[model samples]
Target: MSTVTTATNATTTHRSARSVARRTAWLAGALFWSAFAVLEAVNHGWLAGTLALTFFVLPDLTFLVALDDAPRMAKGQLPPCAVPYYNALHRALVPLALLVAYTVQPFFAWAPLFAALCGWMAHISYDRAFGYGLRTKEGFQRG
Candidate 1:
């Protein structure tokens, strides 16, 4: 009976921890996108600004679709072992990709791509500012 109680407590604690992780991740993501959209809308047209914001969130949305536990992780339900995937999507690869694209086609300015990159940077900045960091196999922790 004592062992059973101990196991139950441990499980509850683990679930709580995962929940915190997911909520924080979602908060950070939301903050980034919101701030980015507002900033872009001030400088660009509303439609373009929102479209850029969508592009910024596209990678994360893709992960949510591809990973079984991604939504759960975002909701703080279960610990996710998706650190690598998260890192890949959150990194500066989008900007770099845009740079490469521009280099390949010097005539095309690719303003929209640049806007998306800005949105991506905004998201990463928000995550760092909010202490969401990244997830690990065990759980989310500050990096």
Candidate 2:
């Protein structure tokens, strides 16, 4: 299900309930990712195991932040945030994919891996489906 609610601020006004809904949707996406960490801990090992999972996530953070400027610098907001979103999903899905390739002992290690990939894919698809993408034109007009 989806919703469309509008809010106006003294400093700014958002157009369409879609903007707020988009933001709310992204928040939920992040929350879902964080929640995956918790579930991963239980399935993969526990608190310590999840901490070990951090080893996988940390490099991803570095790469994502490091590349944050590259796309903007190159595209000048041309390709827009589709680059970051795609990269973020790749950053997330890659390790999870590796986990799938390397996991042993229990079969469920792949579950969180699968969930993370699904979440990433779903968010990207949602954004694309809803026409929610970074602005590409100069002085991008307000919604």
Worst 10 residues of 1 by lDDT: 74-83
Q: What's the TM-score of every candidate structure?
A: 0.49, 0.36
The best candidate by lDDT is 1
Q: Candidate 2, 68: how far from true, in Å?
A: 14
Q: What are the per-residue Cα lDDT tens digits for candidate 2 across 15-130? A: 54666776677657656655655565567555434453544344324234435555445433323334454344444355456546645536545554544444453444344335
Candidate 1's residue-wise lDDT over 1-143, tens digit each? 99999999999999989867876766775676556556656666766576677766765553453466655555542244555667666665555576467668867564555556667766665665565555555545644
Off by over 4 Å in 1: 1-47, 59-63, 66-82, 93-108, 137-139
Global Cα lDDT for candidate 1: 0.62
Candidate 1, residue 127: Cα displacement in angstroms equals 0.7
